[model samples]
Target: MIDFHCHLDLYPDALKLLPIVSARNLFTLVVTTSPKAWLATSNVFAGYENIKVALGLHPEIAEQKAGERLLLLSCIPKAKYIGEIGIDGSPKYKETISLQESILNDTLTECERAGGKILSIHSRNASSRVLDLVEKNCRKSTVVLHWFSGSLTEAQRAQDLGCWFSVGPAMLRGANGRSIVASLPINKILPETDGPFTTNRSAPLMPWEAIDIVNTLVPIWGIPKEDVILQIRNNLAALISEENFQQNHSDTK
Candidate 1:
C-alpha cells in the first residue's frame, strides 16, 4: 500500500514507528510541516528507500515565518519531494493569503528549475489559486493534491492540468468526498493518510490506515479488491518510478 501524505514527525512514537514502516512492504511519503522538521526527519529516515521525507512549509504557519520561504528554496535541490506547501484559505489564515502565495510561488519556481521533484500539495480553501500557480510554474514534476476539497469544476481543471488527487479515511466518509472521487478519473486517484492529523475514531490515523482506503475504494469504484490495489500501486509507480525520477533529474541538466 501507499500513503502519499503522512506526518511521521508528528507521531507520538515516531522513532518506534519508523522501524515498522521501514520493515513493511509499503510506499509512504513522510511529509513535514516545516523545513526544520524536514531536516530532522530526513536524517531519521535516511537511506530508507520506501519512505520519502518531503520538505514542507505549511501555509497555516506561513505568515509568521515568511523567512522560511528562502530556507525552503535553498533546500529544494536536495529534496526529491515537496509538499504541505500550498495555500490554506480557511478563515483563520485568510489574512496571510498573499504570504502563502509568495512562498508557494517561490517553491514552484525552484522546483521547476530543478526539474523533477514529486510534490504532495495541500489546498484547503484556496484550490483555484493553488491550481493556477501549479499550472503556471510546475511542468516536469508529478503533483499529488492531498485531500482536495474543491468543486467538481475545479477538480476537472486540475485534472486537465495533470494533477493527481490523494484520498484518505475522512475523504471516504463524506458525501462530497464520494462525489469528488466519483467525478475524478480512477487513474488519477491515490490513497493517503494525512496521519496524526486525520482520524478514523478518537485517535489520529496511522500511515497503515491507507490500507483501509484501498479496501474502501473497491465498492466505490466497482472494481474488484485485488484490481483496486493494483491500480493504486501502479498509479504510485507511474509517478515515482526510477525512470520518471531519472528523467526529471536529467531535465534539470
Candidate 2:
C-alpha cells in the first residue's frame, strides 16, 4: 500500500510503529510541519527505503515559523520531497494570507532551484492561490494536492497544471470529497491517510490503513476493489518513475 501523505513522526508511538510499517512494505511519505522537525524525522526514517520524509512548513504555522525559511531552503538540496506546504485561507488564518503566500512562493522557488522535488501540498481553503504559486514557480515538479477540498473547476485547473490529488478515507467519507474524487482523472489519483490528524471512530488512522481507501473508491469509480488497488499502485509507480527521472537529470547537471 502507498500512503502519499502522512505525518508519521507525529504519531505517539512512531518509533515502535516504524518496524510494523516496514514489515507491511507500505510506501509512506511522512511530511514534516516545520524544518525544525524535518531533520529529526528524516534521520529517524533514514534506514527505511519505503518511507520518505518531506521537508515542509505547514501554512497554519507559516507565519509563526517564518524565520525558518532559510533553514527550509538550505535543506532543499537534500530533500527530494517537499510538502505539507501551501496556503491556508480558512477564517482563522485569513489575516496572514500574504505572509503565507510569500513563504509558499519562496519555498517553491527554492525547490525549483534544487531541480524540481516531488511536492505534497495542502490547499485547505486556498486552492486557487496555492495553484498560482505552484504554477508560477515549480511547474515541472510532481505536485500532489493532499485532501483537496476545492470545487470541480479548481480541480480541473489543477489538473490542467499537471497536478495530482491525494485522497484519503476521511476525505472520501464526505459527499463533496467523493464528488471531487469522481471528477478527478483516475490516473492522477493517489491514496493517502493524512493520519494522526484524520481519525476513524475517534482513533488516529495509520499508514497501512490507507488501503481502506480502495474500498471507498470502488463504488466511486464503478470498478472492483482489486482494480482500484492496481490503479493506485500504477499511479504511484508512474509518479516514482517521474521523480527518479527528474533526480537523475538533476544529478547530471
Candidate 3:
C-alpha cells in the first residue's frame, strides 16, 4: 500500500518498528508539518528504505516565522517534497494563509531544483490558489495533493496539469471524497490512511487499512484489485524513491 501523507515524526515508536513493518513491504511517505519537524523526521527515517520525508511549513505557523522555517528547511538535504503547505479557510487557520503562501513560494526554488520530486500539497480552503501556485511555481516538479477535498472541476484542473492525488480513508464516509475517488484517473491515484492523525491513535496503521480506501475505487477503475494495487505502487516508487524509482519497483514486484 502507498501511504501518501502521514506525520510519522510525531510518532517516535513507528520509527523503531519500521524494519518489522517494512518487512511486509509497505511504502509510506511521512510528511513533516513544518521546518520544526525536519530534523526529527529525518532522524527517524535515517536508514530506513521504505520511508521518505516530505518537508514544508504548515499554515498554522505564523507568517512572521516563515523565514526561520525556511532556513531550517533549507538545512535539511533529505527532504524530497514540499508539503502540507497551502491556504486554509478554516476559521482557525484563516490568519495563516499569507504565511502559508510565503513559505510555499520560498520552498519552490529548492523544490524545483530537485527535479521530478513528488510534492504532497494541502489546499484545504485555497485549492484555487494552490492550483495557481502549482501552475506558476511547481509545474516543474510532479505534484500529489493529499486528501483532496475539492470539487470535480478543481480535480479536473489538477488532472489537466498532470498533478496526482491521494485518497485517504475519509472517502468511505464523505460525498466529496468519494466523488473524487470515483472520477480520478487510476494511474494517478495513490492510497493512504493518514493513520494516527485520523483517529489520534498511536499504534500505527497497518497497510491493509490503506488498501481498503483504494478498494472503494475499484469499480471506478474496472480492473482487478491486484492491477490497481500494482499501478499505485508504481506511482509510489516514482514519487518516493530517489534516483531508483524503476529499479525499486522491479525489486518490489
Candidate 4:
C-alpha cells in the first residue's frame, strides 16, 4: 500500500513500528514539520528506500521558525520531496498568515531553483492562497495537497494547476470530505494516513492502515474495492514516473 503523506517519526513507538511497516512493505512519504526533524528522520530511514522523508516547515509554526528559512533552503538541494508545507489560515494561526505566505513562497522558489520536488502540502483554511503561490512558483515540481478542506471551485482550480490531492481515513469519515473526494478526478487522488495526529477509535492510525482508505473510496467512486486499490497503485506509479521524468528532463537542461 502507498501512504503518500504520513508523520512516521511522530509516532510514540516509531522505532518499534518501523519493522511492522517494513514487513508490510508500505511505501510511505514521511513528512516532517521542521527542517531539523527532516534531517533526523531522513538519517533514520536512510537505507529504507520505500520510506522517503520530506523536508518541511509546517505553516502552523511558521512564525516561530521563520529564522529557519536559510536552513530549509540549504536542505532543499538534497531533498527530493518537499512538504508538510503551505499556508494555514485557521483562526489560531490567522495572525501569522503573512509570515506563512512568505515562508511558503521562499520554499517553493528554492524548490523550483533546485530543479523541482514532489511536495505534500497543507492548505487547511488557506487553499486559495496556497494554490496561488504554488501556481506562481511551481514549474517542474509535482504537488499533492494533503487532507484538503476546500470548496469544489478551489479544488477544481487546483486540479487545473496540476495539483494532486491526498485523502485519508480521517478525512473520509466526514461528510464534507466525502463530498470533496467524490467531486475530484479519481486519477488525481492519492491516499494518506496523517497518523499520530489522526486517530482511529482513539488509537493513532498506522501507515499500513492506509489501505482502509480504499474501502472508503469504493462507495464514493462506485467501483469495487480491488479496482480502487489498483487505481491508487496506478496513480502512485504515474506520479512517481512523472516526477522521475521531470527530474531527468531538468538534469538534461
> In angstroms, how far off is 248's CA in candidate 1?
22
Give lDDT tens digits, candidate 2, residues 159-232.
99999999999998999999999999999998889999999899999888888888878888999977887788
Q: How do the predictions measure up, each by TM-score? A: 0.93, 0.94, 0.85, 0.93
Of 2 and 3, the candidate ranking higher by lDDT: 2
CA displacement after TM-score superposition, residue 28 of candidate 1 (Å): 0.8
Residue 202 Cα positional deviation in candidate 2, in Å, after optimal superposition: 1.2
Alpha-carbon runs more than 4 Å astray in model 3: 62-67, 76-78, 113-116, 200-208, 238-253
lDDT scores of the candidates, listed in order: 0.84, 0.87, 0.69, 0.87
lDDT of 3 by residue, 102-181 (tens): 66766665677655456788788788878888888775688888788878899999999888887777655687788777
Candidate 4 lDDT tens digits, 1-253? 7788899999998888776676563468899999998889888877766678899998989887888878998999999999889999999999999999998999999999999999999999999999999899999999999999999899889999999999999999999899999989999998899988999998998887888888888888999977887788778779887444223222111
Error of 1 at 109 (Å): 0.8
Clashes of 2: 0
Residue 81, candidate 4: Cα error in Å is 0.4
